[model samples]
Target: MNRFNWTYIDHKNERHHVGLMHGAQSGNLLVYCNTDILIIDFQVLHSHTYSFFIEEEFCELSIEKTADEQYLYSFDLNTEADTPLNRYRKKLSKKHLWQSLAFLAGFLILVFSLTISFTYWNKYNNQHQFAYGNGIQGRETIAQISIDPESEGKLVSYYFVANGKSYRANTKFKENATPFFKHGMPLIAGDEFVVKYAIDDPTINEIDYNRPSRKQISTYRNRAIERHLAFHPELDLDYCSCVADIAFKMKGINGLADLYFQRVSEEENPKHNINSYKRLVRSPKFTQRVEEKCWAQ
Candidate 1:
């Protein structure tokens, strides 16, 4: 017999006493109370131990082991088995927790890969529209610059003419050229710029800023003045003549004048990317920009 305090309540009555229990050979329990004998069959009964205390009114009466190492029970005659919500919390050991984390990480990676693929496809579609569209050949011209309505002032698109028809298209500026990579060429209203375009599809075009006008060249010279002075303060070279020649001759290859002055400053410091003079001699554009724009001075 397992001994523990037992409480029972009937309508308008309460009783408290010891409970005695005995198991029979047939796997049934005989519980003896003050005035009643209750028989429970092991085959038909489900039991659980309460690791936490539960209120008598809400408790699921299951045969339980108390902290004192005694077997006891609360009898709920209405229910035979535990409901899902009342069942014990399934233990999640560290190994299982790690497995769950790994699954979540893999799911996030899949989502990120899909997002990137979609974004790349979207950009490619835009690029294809501009690259393969048809346009009439026209003399080099300066495109009128306007704020892109779709992107606000954050970006600008160019409007040009081909075959006497006006067309609009956005040009792809190099990354980090300004705030947004799509900011287009930073050309002014009257700045000399040109593009190849399809007559039927003006949005499909290629812009060329290689041949700037005299005003544009002057602007470039002014902008580069501070930089040139910072690098070669004592030098007496004219900024416009130095940079415009290199820009038109080299099609705006970067670091030309800087590298030239760098060599002049320290001849022993080996030449930069432009190591071969023969390469420049072979370029007709180089001779043309120099003869027409630079050495004419």
Candidate 2:
């Protein structure tokens, strides 16, 4: 048996305070409203509201939206029966207890495994990070670019040689776009950028370009490009600059051995016309020219 103290106003605007009781034997809620008694089935519409039907109309009651009424009710439902259905329900609750405990044990084991894995990964990362510092300045001898076979569309890898040693790095694009260089510029093969190494051990290396050596390399490359433009007036300064930048970085070259240019124009459609070629020629004799005229033995 459950009882609630409630107050409601009638049609005469008189407040009537009464005790609303649930009869467990009858399985009906007892509501006494102004000299009349109404029996309604107890139902919960949601967490905040309780509902019951009276005279073919739905009635809603909630603590937050109470117009001029209040009620105190118990959440626990009390029932009594010696039926087989009641006995079966009690048996089912006891059976579910072991299943609940097993689920909890599995959840705890998964959490423990993840914790151990994360700890091991953190330890490995910290040890490797400490070994590699800003790398030493090393001249790039060769630069190789290749499309990644494992991925589709604009997945690439850049492999380069510095001081007779090889290194690899990867890049991907959202669209078909040129690979970016340091500072988000277009990256070309044979471009000279600073390489980083560990201070204690030089073998641990990386190509992150925020190094002090880049400024000195850029200055040297610019001087070589100026020398190339002096000898060839027909070549665009911008085109010669790109070639010289790659050449000087690759082999400390003062000028390119071969210079070539091309232009494509369509008379029918101006929009389809390519004004000039973007690629710079890399000559086989370029290294020989650098060895003869630039660096002395």
Candidate 3:
């Protein structure tokens, strides 16, 4: 059983005491005005409103569900019956509702603004750290490249392994950017490149095109070719080696590195079922080179 009480004053300056007794499980309710019992019900299974008169003045008692799914009891007293106290109560209720909505809107705006500010701040902080912090040399594998729909700039996505974990990131280059867009030089997916990343946070990194020398490119190309031939034991080593050398000559170090990294990525994810070597063999340049260098007498 739960008990609730309230006090009210009427138009004639008369004092009144309003009290209620509720039996939650039994659905029994008792309402009292001063010492007089005004209403009684034994079947109050849900929230309800009760209206009664005291000294010719109107009064209302309501039970309703609150925000936390709990029941609340409210009492109101009116000086005249013609005043329609419920209408006034409804107006006050609407005022509170609007106030609550305004408060919520302001809170959401503040949170959104803070989120945007923090994101920019974090990016700026990371750039600063990468620029001045002690960074270690790391190898990055170019995963994909596409033109940004909004900026129409070339976006290069890449990944690197650090501390035995892989981290992925992307950079954007305008169409006129040097080296990347130099005549006869085309950046493609699966290219391996040099990168330096903050030792403490691998996410802060950038590509360094001048980092790889010709010798390093040869080493990468040879290692990749060796792995590919091992994986496909039936492939002719002379033909494969000729094709790889032709590809390096055609695309330069970046091109050959791309082929090597693409093979590495494919090996790492066998389910992808991609054969970059076959694709290379099918290209006209490689086919022509294979005939001229490996088979032509």
Candidate 4:
């Protein structure tokens, strides 16, 4: 207050309070004069710097003299000599940088997550799931074995011939096992049984293990698919079916449409299953020649 008695106020006047560094004091406060206020310096303390509001007829007030450059360093409380606002500016700068970096990282992770989800989701939704061939086709043979009179023909230990190989599958049914047997028995020795297996893991062959029930066949086939895929990690059901068809043809099936399922264990032969299919591509007719000179003795 220049006139300590009265401080000036005008109609076109406004003030900005910058800091109140008075530690717990009620009346002590610091204010920043707006630059819009055309304040005039009371004396040639240096050049025009800042002026306080005086309420008198505008009497001049005296201040210490200093060089012009020194005046830039220090000023009356009305000038920009406050410290807290500068600290606030610095904090705002740091906050802005942190927010920007966080946004960038979150955006990149979102993009990657969407890309991965889309890829797997597409695979799951659009997977090839068609079962090839309407049914089994092949030659028929009557593999006969003596059965208990009460058990009927289902007791016959059957031998099925497929892919130029005769498979002796146990179809012997007992009177005690009859109720379940007649329903689940393979057509006997040398009888062409219709079987389906994953061409991926040919060892997972299914040949009417529980006959007259298609449900069992599907259940076992699904299990086989899971087990084969666990080890193979390649060759899905569609691929396996195609390969099985090729192997069936290579071994010279009697009927292309109705060959029986022969649950044969996959041996290390690697000559008649999916491996053989792959081998055939690498070296043509290898499977054909082996089959032509076949001996499943």
Candidate 5:
């Protein structure tokens, strides 16, 4: 059986709240539950003899999962009664990297299956080009900032014009792929020119490096960025703060933490499988603030 102690330490070391989570690495972590209440368990896949202990009652825990993996589980303890957090957590899904894309991939699956599913789900009947998506067009390489140098780019906001629109997807360097890569020593600012965004949905998002020793496409990619000059270049560089420009040019969700189903009432859920009560009581993100935010009295 997996074993560990969740301990609270008031060590005379520092001040900030520190959460030390030690668990065995294995098949995947599970929100193990009984019939009574929801309970979380950190499944140890990698090592042997795992141990962690906690004082407070924690109903939630996080786990890692790769693509194409589904979790299967069953209740072990005498499930039933008013188990509260323990029972609820069982209904929650393990935190899947498939869900977070945790590790960065330069040439990622750019678009996931869900991204397409949702897009069409809304256009089932009236598939006509109805200026759909709150910022769906934001997918096609809206901006590409060369981190070494500084620049600014523009992407028009159509918020009032449409809802459910997704903005530019912030991607990363892929681990398996040679991947298009760049870095900004100076912080990238909202006003910085990244990419001019020439084409519409479904465009060539490329770059050039000019390294004959490495890849021939480097030169082409470099030239492409060179030619991607912004039409009305903003008066800003990578590190400058345009704070407002950011929300306008980014995707909506990041990971499971954002998965807390707060207002999925109008989320266009085609599955209809969305459980209202499960999301309400089981979600780790749903931990009440009034009880959570207060200091130990």
Candidate 6:
């Protein structure tokens, strides 16, 4: 339940106090203008607008549901007839609306320009090794290759050791141009690859996938299973292994890695990863396969 209060000055130079009480879960609403009860509806499950009269002035009260399942209450006074005050308020409202839209458009354009400039700058820095000739060649291991479910983009995480310190970084590419696909071979975890980084700031680096690793895939599936269980401690090892095996067979190692570690924050949406995993495990094909392979007595 939440309560909101505000003050309104009417055309008659009279001051009125407006108030609203809303029950978020119970779907109840109550509106007040001054000492008078304007609207009372105990079954407001959705957004609605109410029309009424305050003295000779027409008024409208709107109740809207927001994205986070909260209610927003708004009141507009003397909007129906073209009275002097109504016309003035209409002009003022239009002025404010236009000002707000203009501000938003300008802000978005500025952001777009900054983003484009920064992207080009970063690309140039990486290409030219920050304009410093102190860049040294380093070997980075393929820690993980994750595929985004929505965009089908590949994110590759790798790490390199410099001056006895390990630095981890990730890069993104479209599904077609993944760095993991090299010389008609799909690279996996534990395979070492080539990268170039600045000697002063090793973090400023880029992948050089033209030089592929000689090492083969090693324990990639096992590592994915371990990571999945680490993230979802509520699940048993047996269940995790079962799901990992099924996902690998169905979608291969990249899909399995994405399912296990696609970087969803637990603090943001605690149940997001588990909920997606549950949906997959509950699917008919997954359920049948798990029962046949994992649950066999």
lDDT of 6 by residue, 1-297 (tens): 878887877667988888888888887888888889988888786899988777667777888888887777888874757766677788999999999999999999999999999998876766575534445444344332344446435554677777678777766655546433422224454456666666656776666554544332235556667877887899788887877878767655544545554455555334334454566667898889988887773
Relative to the unseen true structure, what is the C-alpha lDDT of residue 258 in candidate 3, on a scale of 0 to 100? 41
lDDT of 5 by residue, 53-78 (tens): 22222322333333444322221222
The collision pairs in model 1 are: 134-198, 135-197, 135-198, 135-199, 142-193
- Where is the poorest 10-residue window by lDDT in model 1? 175-184
Residue range 110-208, candidate 1, lDDT tens digits: 999999999878556654665664233324455655555466443656687766877776644322243211111234444445566544444545775
TM-score comparison, 1 vs 5, better candidate = 1
- For lDDT, candidate 1 versus 5, the one ahead is 1
List CA RMSD, all candidates: 15.3, 17.3, 16.3, 22.2, 37.9, 28.5
Best by lDDT: 6
lDDT of each: 0.48, 0.46, 0.65, 0.38, 0.28, 0.67
Ranking by lDDT: 6, 3, 1, 2, 4, 5
3 or 4, which is superior by TM-score?
3
Residue pairs clashing, model 2? 135-196, 135-197
Using TM-score as the measure, the top candidate is: 3
| Candidate 4: C-alpha lDDT | 0.38
Question: What range of 10 consecutive residues in model 5 has the weakest lDDT sum?
Answer: 248-257
C-alpha TM-score for every candidate:
0.30, 0.28, 0.40, 0.24, 0.14, 0.31
> Model 5 Cα displacement at 245 (Å)?
21
Kindly report which residue stretches of model 6 are placed more than 4 angstroms away from their true locations once superposed: 1-86, 93-97, 108-112, 123-125, 128-155, 163-166, 169-185, 210-297
Native-structure RMSD, model 4: 22.2
The deviation in Å at residue 290 for candidate 2 is: 17
